[model samples]
Target: MLRVFQECPELKLSSHGRKMAKFGRATPEIEGLVVASGLSPLIMCSLDTGDRRLMSTFVEYWHKETSRFHLPVGEVTITLDDVTSLLHLPIIGVLHSFELLHVDDVVDMLVELLEVSIAEARVEKIQCHGSYVRLSWLHDVYQMKI
Candidate 1:
């Protein structure tokens, strides 16, 4: 699973979407990788969790029914090197706010989710705005540039 996800990090990997595609099986591998990597909880969150619809094939099927309001959504930009650079170092950070709705808000929720994931993963930056959400996270500092 880790191998495949590592190879194709962008593959939609929502187990709730449907029967796992032959190639989709890699989705679960992320959990094992998180454990093996011994990364911080934030990093683990990034590897283990993702937007349900991000993993689903049908765009319409992806929606955050649990969100109370238009979730505070944002795009985050981060670098693997920036994070991995802190190996064995204690992590300190906070969660970014998300404002995306659950129903009929697939793209909005995904963007918000990605932002949260970035924060949990110790991302250093975020800029989710405009037509395309732009979020960036780096290591060393939690410098959110939204």
Candidate 2:
């Protein structure tokens, strides 16, 4: 099994650092809003880079067909309950469906949400190269606002 894993192709892990770690703690005002939004647990949760060897072993055991880990003991699958338990996040909530919006719409949203000028919003959109903006950018904007 160890030899098989060693022979297998290396999994391409993301190079991006942990977003949550950089997020830090929210201000008193923002903390209230976060709690009201039922995302307080996420704020409380601390993140750390886990054992890559263990992760690689798990990846090797993962069966794509059934989406279960074919461990020597038995098959196992991570459930929503597991996520809730591990992360202390609320599983029950209104499901948010994200739809890709036009660049103009994204600009409009940024302007309205961040209270930035249209020109500023457009510049941010151009910098991001799409509708998706960096959380760090958002945080900076939010800090400026406060």
Candidate 3:
């Protein structure tokens, strides 16, 4: 019943690689805090269909040992944030693209995507040229070519 919208990188920080200790700890107290803060929007938004079931489900999702969230639509991941935080790096955004790739080409495509994502200062138009990939945004371009 889990829809994967994003995938987590196979990287581990501690023995409990799947578990996000900080977020897991924070999940339990989020509801109470949001409620006590008089944030009706937060509560209402989470409580879609006027039922608390969805909100509880989201909270449960957050409490999972893994950093993936499975909602009715698709999965959401914290892998980017996790990776960036681990490296003490700052991130402005994340960009990912998926297509029906041939089995033999998927890994190569993924690597290319990651390279393009990292090289570009900002994400915009992503174009592929033979063995090279290009990413453009407004007028700024990255130093990496291909």
TM-score of each: 0.15, 0.68, 0.18
Lowest lDDT 10-mer window, candidate 2? 14-23
Candidate 3, 74-124: lDDT as tens digits: 788877587455544444445535455543353344345334343341222
The TM-score of candidate 3 is 0.18
Candidate 1 deviates by what RMSD? 19.9
Better of 1 and 2 by lDDT: 2
Better of 2 and 3 by lDDT: 2
Which pairs clash in model 2? none
Q: How well does model 2 score by local distance difference test? A: 0.76
lDDT of 1 by residue, 62-128 (tens): 2346322221253233345555454443344554465754332534433354344533332222243
TM accuracy, model 2: 0.68
- Leading candidate by lDDT: 2
- All candidates' lDDT scores? 0.36, 0.76, 0.40
Judging by lDDT, tell me the better candidate of 1 and 3: 3
| Candidates ranked by lDDT | 2, 3, 1
lDDT of 2 by residue, 81-117 (tens): 9988988888897877868899999998777666779
RMSD of candidate 3 to the truth, in angstroms, is 19.2
